[model samples]
Target: MAQTKQTRGACAFCGRQMTGNGMVKHLSACPKRKDTLGESNPKSGKEEKIYHLKIQDAWLNDFWLHLEIRSSATLKDLDSYLRSIWLECCGHLSQFSTKGHLGEEIAMDSEVSALFHPGLELTHIYDFGDSSETLIKVVGEREGTPLNEHPIYLMARNELPEVETCACGKPGAWLCMDCTESEDEVALLCEKHAKDEQHQDHNLMPIINSPRTGRCGYAGPADPPY
Candidate 1:
């Protein structure tokens, strides 16, 4: 079977699909947010953004952390979730990569906080040195380091429901059943669909017209066991 081209395009920051770049751009330009650097805060303001993350650890085949969290959630919060899920074998903060990428070297203390600030939906993939099934690079640059200061570009921004109506935009009601091949190809989950409890990716069966089922899609021989 041949899967169609669902990846559409690539993201500037990472190599993933344009969706990743779009998602970041949306968070960066969210109108609901006042500058976080301001001394005062908007009491009723809320920055509503969502992101996707996959646990690429080789040994932990039982864990599937396909979750959506607010942009404000901290890495510490995720650490807590891991603790709850794997009380005995959870990879502690020290064991995990600070940059979220497979082998990105970074300081997990305060610098990562500066780079991966809140209100940004980031899709991070990790490898616990098990079998290395990961293909994406979830990298973050040092706060003042060259890698952090380098400029990355994107083709387009991801869509969000809370944003203002654009003259050239359409509803992001579509689903991206990405084939998950190159690090440049990313799986996109629509924020509106998830929040409304309307249509979900998990429920979206390949209707035979989906692009992910074509030759370029690479769905392999069996569907995921969920």
Candidate 2:
């Protein structure tokens, strides 16, 4: 079997970016956070409950993540975390609720303990106009080590999906939007091919890490230090 490459994650304390699993180990012994290590030790909190969340784009299975969060964390905190990792394209309003495709809204301030459990699922909507919906499930709960200061901790995420290649045999990283709509053929191309005379005037979009890729004005996230 082949090994899967881990997704990139930024350490909450030092802002150093590494693989998601690497970040976990990095956070465990980050010198700046050593003083708080005792509080995060799993052995010390056998009775404390943590929520294990499985989150993904509602329509795409390729983009997903496993996250562990404290039950005390508010939905707003989860919202912020999601935006930082996957959804924040603009300063658009977002919400979480039982409704899958827009329905009764739950307040952002709701606590995870109040709204989530071992089997419950919820939907999150970001940007009503060019919205992206995420399906969140409380997969399970267990006593475990907690994140130092960060409200959310990434445990795992899917590796980058393989994309089509250009006619010249290089990996495709740019999608020609105009060709995709007007021409019947796939418009994906490598950066070199994207500059070809045939596609000179076509609008090209760079492939990115978000589920909102190729969607309304969603280029990517301007990730913060955390």
Candidate 3:
């Protein structure tokens, strides 16, 4: 087995690529971001608030994203963005919930300004049966910017998860679900190898970009409609 490659991402401010944690550290010191942090308001004049968000798969920390968005935006906007970027597979229903208020779930139309604050954490569950849960935290908040008009802006994201290489050295593109008895012999195959007779009835699943991959009917989204 080869060593798994570390995940990397580009700084939204400088476009310099670094590890997930590295980008978090870099954003605090990014010169470009710093310059904007000092500016007061955008010409639009509507009061704005910048919210820093950290989102990750409830089951796997490797699939995650850091975002900067306007507090005025609605959960619907966030839902749309999330669907576009990762979770939209079968038009499943989703919702956000705070700790004790689980029964009082917030709908997609809920405004961020009304429900979120620094230090607040929420859970997002997509699809009721084969659900994909995401842990979300509102890490910071400040006066917003002209860029806030973008609804949702991606600041950083985890690099793709690492996996074993195929016999030919190509990265594994499929994982066979039928070989669970032999953990060491579990099949991780590239496209060409996946077509072999041994894998015909094994229920092959493609490795994909979303944390929802291999769950329910999710297979990642098309381009963002925004």
TM-score for each candidate, following the candidate numbering = 0.27, 0.74, 0.80
Error of 1 at 200 (Å): 47
* Cα shift from native, residue 72, model 3 (Å): 1.3
Stretches of model 1 off by over 4 angstroms after superposition: 1-45, 60-62, 87-93, 98-226
What does candidate 1's lDDT look like per residue over 1-226, in tens digits?
2122322233333334443334444434434322321322334234333333433223222222223333344555554443333221223223334324445543323223344433333322322332122222232211211111111212222222121111224332333444235434533334444344433335332212112222222222222111
lDDT (tens digit, per residue) of candidate 2 on 1-226: 1123434655545667666435445655677645543456554333356777778787765567768778778999989988888877668999988857656789999987787788888899999897889998887675656754566776666555566677789988887888775433557889898888988888787877667767666676524326
The runs of at least 3 residues in candidate 3 whose Cα sits more than 4 Å from the true structure, single-residue gaps closed, are 1-6, 35-47, 100-104, 167-169, 177-186, 197-204, 222-226
Residue 32's lDDT in candidate 1: 34
lDDT of each residue in 3-38, candidate 3, tens digit only: 245567677777888776566668777898777656
- The candidate that wins on lDDT is 3
lDDT of 3: 0.73
lDDT of each: 0.30, 0.71, 0.73
Judged by lDDT against the true structure, how good is candidate 1? 0.30
What are the RMSD figures for all models against the true structure?
14.9, 6.7, 3.8
In model 1, where is the ten-residue run with the lowest total lDDT? Answer: 144-153
- lDDT for position 169 in model 3: 92
TM-score pick, better of 1 and 2? 2
